[model samples]
Target: MKHQTERQAWMEILAKSSVVNIERQVQTLGKLPEYSFLRSPEIGLTMLRGRAGGTGEVFNLGEMTITRCVVKILDTIGFGYVGGRSKRHAELAAVCDGLLQQNEWSFTVQNQVIQPLQTIIQQKQEQQQRQTEATKVEFFTMLRGE
Candidate 1:
């Protein structure tokens, strides 16, 4: 269960990160192990669903384009799914996933690649939150008696 949670966290970070950011961080890892594609990167559409008025009935929001790839490195397999049609992004994500699964490379990959990417993501979220708060409005009522 712990292992699954850790993978889930890292995978979420990978999915949220931009391809350029991920690629930049990955470049610091030096030589990468050879990997073969288990499933070639492919683009497809997934239906998006949304709720009306936050808690009302759900409705289809429309379809979004996504690209997915699977790769095998040694005995472990990795999968990557990203929004849009960037095949290279999907491939790089798969490579990172595969490396993160191996005991020998997990620590290095997590520190050098995943941690920085996660930091960048957190910073962006914080900035957005601050911006939203800045626009917050407050309302009050004044009473008049006859």
Candidate 2:
């Protein structure tokens, strides 16, 4: 597997993170640094696109509720876009993103937040794959002797 850049990894973590999980983790980080919201957390709708049966025609699935925010920590800017309508989640994600950009907190945040979240996400995916594979069906046919 190709090595993932720091920014890319954090982006994934922020996107996939659970609202409660993120809230809890961020709470443990103690007081936040001085920062301002470039954009306050706001809920919006985004078009969801889907491919039929994973190989068929593409179609509009539906509209999904999304919350987004942007924050600036010192000279660095960070953004968060999360699925669902939780404003708090978006805010925390934005804050965490900004913290992750800072050199002083990057390694600590990576080990405490991003790394553990990645592990949890990986485990969930593996469990899902196992469950799906367990339900697989195989068909076979045997020739009859004439």
Candidate 3:
């Protein structure tokens, strides 16, 4: 599902200000019956490629390790995954997902958490792109006469 404007605003506030404590927001949100079973993963899967040692074409090797988590509120579930090899994140996600499916946690989950996290991830990507563009450098070599 798409994120709401309020979620986007919150994410922007988070991105722009270090003074805004995320944990506080999380805690506040956590108290809501809608966000009781949310989980954030620590790692995820990345595509791996195989290439020759010196100079050769690259080939798709296989899927690399990953981690993921899920947050559930009522009928809504938010799944988060990161690229890397880590079992902890995957386990956390699984547990959240399981909790979401259980009868006890089905009615307390909130959908708001997904939007903020999604916004933060997008913002982080944009920041990385901006930083990369800002730091782009080029060098030219001078030719010498023998």
Candidate 4:
């Protein structure tokens, strides 16, 4: 397996992050540079696939709604694809993606935006895990008349 690049990791984090959290963190950036929409936010549907039992044959489960956008900041282009039909979320994600590619803003965005978003995701996952663990059932076998 190949390791993901830093950009890939951050992009994944952005995609998984909630729009509310993203907007909150991005607000701290103060001012943002001007950008043009290469592809304005558009809503569409993508085929969702699934396996029978995690290892079985793949099949089309259904279609899921998605929003995608593309933005150009200076010479760099950013792309965002997110679940549901939130155009604002898609635009913000694209802006973050473009900013992350710039050397001047990369470090600041990494520290302020990416890290916090990743932490939030981890915390949520941990909380969900704890909740699930609480409902786990244990099975035991006992000898009867041996």
> Model-by-model lDDT, in order?
0.92, 0.85, 0.49, 0.93
Best by TM-score: 4
Point out where model 2 deviates above 4 Å: 1-5, 51-59, 142-146
Q: Please identify model 3 stretches exceeding 4 Å from their true place.
A: 1-58, 67-82, 98-110, 135-146
For candidate 1, the per-residue lDDT at 7 reads: 85
TM-score: which is higher, 2 or 4?
4
Q: Is candidate 1 or candidate 3 better by TM-score?
A: 1
State in Å the error of residue 93, model 2.
Answer: 1.1
Backbone clash pairs for candidate 1 read none
Candidate 1: tens digits of C-alpha lDDT, residues 48-76? 99999979999999999999999998789
User: Cα RMSD (Å) per model?
Assistant: 2.8, 3.1, 9.1, 2.1
lDDT, model 4: 0.93
lDDT of 4 at 121: 100
Worst 10 residues of 2 by lDDT: 23-32
lDDT of 2 by residue, 3-118 (tens): 99878778778788898787777766777789898999999999999999988999999999999999998778889888999988888788888888888988888888888788
Error of 2 at 8 (Å): 2.7
Q: Write the per-residue lDDT of candidate 4 for residues 1-146, one digit (tens) a residue.
A: 28999888988898899999999999988898999999999999999999999889999999999999999986789889899899998999899999999999988988989999999999999999999999999978778973
TM-scores for the candidates: 0.89, 0.83, 0.37, 0.91
* Best candidate, lDDT: 4
Lowest lDDT block of 10, candidate 4: 137-146
TM-score of 2: 0.83
